[model samples]
Target: MLLLRQRGSLSASQLADELEVSTRTILRDIEALSAAGVPVYVNRGRNGGFSLLPGFRAELMGLNQEEALALLTAGSIGGRQVFGLGSALSSAMRKVVDAIPAGHQAAATDAAQRILFEPQADLLSRYRLAEGISETVMNEVRRSVLDGRKLRIHYAAEGRDAAWRHVDPIGLVTVRERSYLLALVDGHDRTYRLSRVLAAEALAAPAERPSEVNLAQLWEARSARFRAGEVQFIVAARLDPARREELAETALAIVHETAESDGWLRMELTFQDLRHAAWAIWKLGVDAEALSPPELRDVLHQHAVEIAARYSPRGPTLATDA
Candidate 1:
């Protein structure tokens, strides 16, 4: 029933392909469902397929109070189209609603509605273009991952031109609404963000991935490295009390700390690289001041001087003015 609801109709062969079974199996199952009083029928022609009668729906999986609350805690992430699970999540959400006792559905809906998700208005935006991904290319990418096959992809990395490459697509995931394919390139793992994928062709050859692939474990390891100060530097900054929470978001862990005069916080933080610290503190502006590590302070000073120069009036030499 769920499958029929997800797709209005399917031929026997198509159902067999999806279920990894023979067409005879699907035909027998169809007969059994009909025998059980299901409103299933088939159209016998070139454009015909098996379909459920209109307004027919099967009973949904039950959701206990804890399960309902857990889905509610997911907080519409399932509906955000992240990882392309929106349809499945929507169907699941409908099931959750349906499985609730008649008297409790309204209460569940009301509780979910009470939660709000507010995203910051960062200088960089995350919305997609109107003319989004090509259906053909995205389909091939997904096919390769699900089928455990290799892929020939035209990918572009940051600050470089696009190039075509062969990859073994292990899995695909969405982090912060951004899509990425975790694949093996040149026998090493690499994360290719979807925005950088210009084109893709799914290859029939099986991927050279490990027999046991764990997406969660792989993502966690990569994320830890990314947050662990790539170049490994110690940052000493005098931060205003107001920016305390802001600093927590960037650092992997707070290595050390101390109190300062006038409610300011002197902290020892870690960053991936020097460039990382430079670009990061630049944003905090006056809220944070790099104290130790002369190199970091130098970077900030140079940036400040440059900004001052841009706003300074274009003028003749001082001697000429005199």
Candidate 2:
């Protein structure tokens, strides 16, 4: 139903591939939809597919109060603002709320208020948000993905100057507040950070991409392959119970972890190198202890000594520009 509404029409094979089901299953589902009074129509030909009749729309009447409340509360988190869908989400939510029966509407609204999600920073650590992307560039990239057009992007990759590249935009993905454009360059998979896109242009050429894409599966496979190629420097440590979640968010990866009897967290972690490990542990201040790899402990100790010396009253006065 959603695919028909969004794309106007799609073949059984296309629907099966997108949904990860067999063509037989898709045909059965189509029959089921029609039997359930959904206005599904099929066109039989080499270049034909199924579509919904004009003026036919799936309604919110099927949603019960509890289900509606869950969606309403989830929307209240406001994460859609980062994806440029805030206004659209607001409008959709209004329609959802208005569709509830008058007797249950007040109860559902109250239930939604009982659930709260705060996206604020932690008190003990400095939180840094992801870099912002240009709205114009994002819009252009989005257009290429939705319209199945090739894109020409001026991108600045890590340690490289901005350069023009042509790619077929597959999809857009947001992970841990950072947005990435999953694309194909020279018929190979590539990922680009949205923040690094200095400019983007949609091309008239149609994108040569798969008829169907499982974005989450694609992202997971690419991410696994990326991690496998990186250098791994493992460290064993003890971390504060209160800062466990913070450490997980900040570190490259927590390879292994367990809660100790004493309430602290004991863990094995992987980092890029010695310097990376030292910097991460140092950020936690006294809350984290490097338990092994004598060199890591030595590095942290030396850094602490240097910091103490720089702050000593007898040491050189803090520099000031006059």
Candidate 3:
């Protein structure tokens, strides 16, 4: 309708291409709009096409204070781009901006800029990594998930080539600028990076999933299980006061900790596994020490010995001890 009103007239094929629908669907919509008394009309000549009655300007949809504010805020956050809805969101937001009572639009625009979501403190390292996504493919996956239908995806895991699989998509999520699709394959939940998906096809077959699904609960449960590790171990360490914040970022959790008279922190923490704890302590360098759980200390010692041996002309002989 907007296109008809603004451009005066548009052919059915033009509308179909612009909206990514079949010409038949476009014609059906024209008939439906006319039947609904929307004043839509079609002309039948070389320069003739679909158009609205002369001087038509449809009134915009109504929006409440909270709803209007949400649209403004959401546009600022760029969530639309993550879901491949950038163009659609832009069109919707333009309508919303037009619909907002003239008196409130300026205030709404000003309010959105005050809040921000910063994922990384260092701006230089915070680069967007999303790649190889097309708006059409994303919309297909999104629609299938919402429609309770299965999707045929050509997925490539971390080090594998893409292979087609029919999976039940549970939900989609965006963290930072990357998007993820959580789905079920062979009755097990798996998370796939949207960037790694080579193609997507919304299948007609219904998805096999629980009647009622809570993606958030499922995501958290799966994350906890994956992090809980096969063998849970406790790590005790003496961490430097200045490196406290840095250490916090490295460890999964600090079970317990206290300040010592010498300005070090005596702490017990959980590690997903032995290797996780070793790598974390290794990052702390001289500022932290793994003090207990003989295995953790042993691994740290082994890592340090190997690192030192690499520089010592004493060679592979000493590196073997590590």
Considering every candidate listed, which one attains the maximal TM-score? 2
Q: Candidate 1, 103: how far from true, in Å?
A: 3.3
Q: Mark the regions of model 3 whose C-alpha exceeds 4 Å error after superposition.
A: 1-57, 64-66, 119-128, 131-137, 159-162, 230-236, 255-258, 268-286, 290-322
**Pairs in steric clash, model 1:** 229-271, 229-272, 230-272
Q: Provide the lDDT at 113 for model 3.
A: 67
* lDDT at 203, model 3: 94
Candidate 1 lDDT over 65-111, as tens digits, reads 66786686574643255544545576676667667665676787777
TM-score of each: 0.63, 0.67, 0.64
The number of clashing residue pairs in each candidate reads: 3, 0, 0
Better structure of 1 and 3 per lDDT: 3
Better of 1 and 3 by TM-score: 3
Give candidate 3's error at residue 161 in angstroms: 5.3
Query: Candidate order by lDDT, highest to lowest?
Result: 2, 3, 1
